[model samples]
Target chain A: MARTDPDISPAPPATERGRRTRRKLLDAATIEFGERGFHEASIASITRRAGVALGSFYTYFGSKEAIFRDLVRDLSEGVRQAAAQSLAERELDALETERAALAAFLAFAREHKEIYRIIDESEFVDPESYRLHYEKTAERILGRLRAGAAAGQLRGDLDEAHAWAIMGMNVFLGLRYAVWSKGEEDRPEHAAQAAATILSEGIGPSDA
Target chain B: MARTDPDISPAPPATERGRRTRRKLLDAATIEFGERGFHEASIASITRRAGVALGSFYTYFGSKEAIFRDLVRDLSEGVRQAAAQSLAERELDALETERAALAAFLAFAREHKEIYRIIDESEFVDPESYRLHYEKTAERILGRLRAGAAAGQLRGDLDEAHAWAIMGMNVFLGLRYAVWSKGEEDRPEHAAQAAATILSEGIGPSDA
Candidate 1:
């Protein structure tokens, strides 16, 4: 939406530069924090990893905590967007819905392993950041469940608030695939199927 | 089971002393790693926290890594034992059976928060440990699922190999609730219900 002409070109805005720098710092922070945890990840390391310089790191964010808060916010939004996009692609049945959700989540985690690790390690530094992460995730899945329930696709006894917990459970499953299982395991699709099955059938006493 | 006289024991023996020392070090390590994390916790700090001399610390644990491995194994076994106990207590309906399993998991986590942290952090140290943890859990859960299937409780479409993935997912759910939820959200009961719904309903395409 910027008007650009030969003679009257808008001065390529300073805020845009800051925005780019901020994003770079966040990306670096994710990898760094993912590698060295939240507490151990120093600003110097983050800046070095970002290649943005130490002063620029401070210019863009207040502290490590600020970076983490923003990181959490970005991850929360990214997950919501991903799930929403995946949901929009089809009208799945109950089992297919979980498969779809698991596939979407596995894809998201594959792309953002650092962010997932950052969010997980954040539990050691600030409990609230961790809480907020799940709460946001819960909100998205709960929204889905509410819609599904209203549409008669889900059970009536479903706890709206616990939707994220269930989804988060699946989301965290991708972590094992990401961090633990090196290239030797089953494909993501198979894992998704497994998760879908477990979700649809109770591990203990499902009559299904 | 020892050949030593239990009826009139005086000194518990040098081997017993070493065992006691090792036990103390592991206990202290769990609390230390749980509170300060693995990287931040030092041998000196753990000994001080445990009120033991530095020399005695080395006498028990060769290094913190050894202590961490033991803790992870110990915790994993304890959790499985707890789950086994809960399964033993019930011939309940679908919902109650799932609920009982969840209750057992929550109880294990609550009592072993430190051990939980140790295993969680271990993923970063040697990625293999994470899979090792998952494999141990999966074998047990899959064994149970197979038993359930033979008993005609579980569905036929389930894969036994992916039991590790399912166990990985559920373990994270238990952990996410314990750590991410910060003891505020009580999802153990609800998790059982949601899991029951998933199993009975299937997350795949429904017949209706």
Candidate 2:
């Protein structure tokens, strides 16, 4: 299946069989890697979890690193698509728009905690993979900001470059409250509201 | 033995001999781990780079994981102390305070790129580590928001829990920007102003 996000595209498996096998491997890897870190996680365990031959694992990707890269590519694409879809569905009000964005992030993180964890851990294990993750997020966010600016919903004078900065802050909050704060008390919905407030308000009095 | 930030109580080596040896290891590990992915990096290579014995690596820390922990803890504390010191040095105006915070983050990232990279990477490897990081940062930002609220700088209507929601957003942004973007492209300073604008201002023109 194709990923809808513009910044990153999934390199879907070459054939139907490849796609099924690939999906199984990726899904298995995400959970395995999430539960046991990269160092502790093993391919044998992943393939067993996937119910595939160990040979098939290497047949699709060269190594664990390669599999992780594809996973990043997939998750990043998922995030972009989710963001775009959310933005598209919301009314043009700034508050509603921010809620839609943060909701999309929280939803994604909830469903794909393991994948996000893999991507997060991959940063040190593999900077290239992490770079791919950041580029996709920044690009997707910049696109939305550009649209917000053009619509006159977001502030003017600031460029897309800066809009991405705020997006980074808002989404990172969701990442923290959702992904990082597992089991601990969390208020993701309220957190989303606060971020939206900050995005809309600028921490200073209106006159300033 | 400890990381002592002259400005903030932090880290350094334990004994002079320990200091020299540990410095070589920490410095080497930073480059090795940050520049090379953790998996490809071996203790043998790290020892070689530090010009220390492989046996000596164990003396510093039981395992590579332990070394990574220290590096992460030290970096995390360094960042907190630096941000606090920045806030303390002056009675920064609202926007100025944001600028100082952003500038402090950039400085920390630049000075200890490896450490930031590791901490960022740690989220995936050990989520407990990531949670600790989030809590430490949440404490700093929330403290500021609480102080601001007391001074009537921020909206008192939002509870402490709500203030934390706001804090999550920035923690996310700092980690993403620190790890990925080069230069001042992810200008937290400017972004803070932009964000502060909305947190204080209602999304619409008047009600806030």
Candidate 3:
């Protein structure tokens, strides 16, 4: 999605080796920043963790702030790709698409438990990236809702607010069921089904 | 109710004047912490902002961390009161109650725009308080949902996941429509009504 700002970050790696090195740094950063936070994290620790040379850090990122900003966008892209992959796996109605999307998200969150910490920390480290993450996510969701409405499978009046609400629901559900999960009862699919039910029929009395 | 950790904070003021001074300090702390954040914020600055003696700060709170924790709890209390006052104004059906509470919350967020920053920052400054805030808020929502189901208003199958989903919906809606509101079209009631609609009826095709 070309989320990185050219002014702040270096151009993407043109070679396979360079790309692998950059990917390694971002993975190390996810753990470094996630464990120590922005103020405490350092390039030395990240490069060391990635097993890359210290001078190579500047090949992809300009500075600590630049890397942090890029990391936020990277994580946002990861979230987007997760949903995209899930939706592409099968043809489903609007509601099932949302269910499948959320299920994928929960699985992603569980695997990358530090994601919540990183994104939440972005509010302080890089406010613009933090804001963009949600804005872009809501835009994607609104687009889905519009398509659903066009297909006559969803209410035609759905708008930005609905998208934000659904985004919020999925984010918080992942926080509770995936990040803070206690045991087996907090299954990702179980949480996804509960959320999907809300979109499909709501919590209103069934007979009513 | 008593959200403060007694060991970290002092006893409540015994007299009205003492109470007033304590209240003033907390109000000032909100602005100080909200603007400068926890790290840059100082007891002297908070006292100066409150127009109280610096030494008197010790009477209410033990240290900077203590007051920050207390401030988080105070804001949490404010949120609770906002919902309680709205719910008390008039008897509402279960769905209407959710609408009113969200409307009140939106109004509160608009007035205290810095609230989102403060609460979100609490994740790093005082993890326990941040955790408590969401946990307690979700508990309150679940309580209301249980009451609704008991009264035969909502679906009997509603559970903790439903409460978390609704809480997430309200929080993100407030973040978008209230704290980051642009102008006239993003009215609090309008957003509240949209969310209430989700709870009242699923966004499925109406005829279905």
Candidate 4:
């Protein structure tokens, strides 16, 4: 189900300026919650970070919890767009699509290192958003799998479990190579290729 | 970084009776930390739950944070034991070993549904424990992959990324199918089979 729960949902800002301010607040909130966590973070700090007026905070978000929920959704959307942008750059088969999407995700995660902390904290701060984030991501992956199956690329029997497994793999790979990366040696492309190999050919020996 | 960091490490009990008391406190700590989390969880509550005297807490753990760290390590050991127990039951090839390990993990997660929350919360409460848990688990998985490769059952090129990917797949599958499971229909064996399929044969079409 879509996250139409109005109680936690922030109303969309109308004007172009309003949207930019909202985006700035979200970016600031990401850092706030990512570092300070839900309990330690405050609306005042987020507004200060965004350089927006304290009174203007309520114009968009109802409260701290509301913005945190919205932030998770925003991050989710960013993940979706990253994959979409990567897939649009060139034509590729289903396996390559997964590889490219993961590559994009790794690159995104590297830039936004706080993502894992903020998202993982949601499990406690806002359980609904936390669950929704993974559920929606898994759903998107399932959709892709189904499309691949329909195109006679992936296995016909791919199901929700398969989607979850793939999501798990991508998320963990990001955690290792992106979030906890040492340096340039932890290349996103190499990680993506490793995952692609698993999908294109299982880890079993080539002859096996 | 063997996690022998003296600050967080709990001392071993000197006698069998002392050991039992320590075990009782840890078991109670699991329920306490699992339910109330590290901050809300109190030593008195855990001691009361364990039916041990309040003074006995310090005999085992130094503080609430100490107990929480130990609890995470205990859970990590439990996971390791589950896989070890499963693998010990019979001889299997690389794919089968991975499948059986996941099956054991799913069963463990189902029985201890509080596991995901506890382990995840460790990320916020005890960052070192959280990172160590995953790192150690991934190392174990890599060990298995290496063993498989040496046995000629898996690709010789398998590395740390493959292990992390497999660990992620297992973790996410357990989250969806075990923790958030609807009912018996979400069988551990079924989820394990789905994961095993990915490792044995990629999700690509049979002929592809």
**lDDT (0-100) at residue A110 of candidate 3?**
93
Collision count of model 4? 0
Listed for each candidate, the true contacts retained, as a fraction, are 0.29, 0.39, 0.79, 0.82
Local distance difference test, candidate 1:
0.65
> What are the C-alpha RMSDs, in order, of all predicted structures?
8.4, 6.5, 3.6, 3.5
Candidate 2 accuracy as lDDT:
0.66
True contacts kept of 3: 0.79
In order, the interface RMSDs are 4.4, 4.1, 0.7, 0.6
- Give the least accurate 10-residue stretch of model 3 chain A, judged by summed lDDT: A1-10
lDDT tens digits, residue span A1-208, model 3: 6565534878899999999999999999999999999999999999999999999999999889988998999999999999999899899999998899899899899999989999999988888899999999999999999999999999999999999999999999999999999898878777887799899988888889
In the range A127-168, model 1's lDDT, one tens digit per residue, is 676777776666666776666767777655556434644664
Give the per-residue lDDT digits (tens) of candidate 3, residues B1-208: 6665544878888999999999999999999998998899999999999999999998999889998888899999999999999899998998888889899899899888878999999999899999999999999999999999999998998888888999999999999999888798888777887798888887889889
- lDDT per prediction? 0.65, 0.66, 0.91, 0.91
Q: Model 1 over residues B1-208: C-alpha lDDT tens digits?
A: 6543322213322697677766777778778888888788888988887778997765555567766766777677777788778888757653355456666886678677676667767767545666577677766666666666666776545454346544544565666565445555665666555555554554422544
Please give each candidate's TM-score: 0.77, 0.77, 0.96, 0.95
Tens-place lDDT per residue, model 2, B1-208, is 4443222323445789988888788878888878775556678888999999888776666667667667667677888888779889989764456557756775676567676667766665455676687677767676776676667666554444444554543444555555445555665555455444445553333433
lDDT digits (tens) for residues A1-208 of candidate 2: 6433322334556899988998899889888888987788888999999999998776677677677667777777788788778788746665466668777888788788776667767666676877767766666666666666566676544554354555565556656677656554676776677666566664654345
DockQ-better candidate, 1 vs 2: 2
**lDDT, candidate 4, residue A200?**
85
Clashing pairs in 4: none
The ten-residue window of minimal lDDT in model 1 chain A covers A4-13
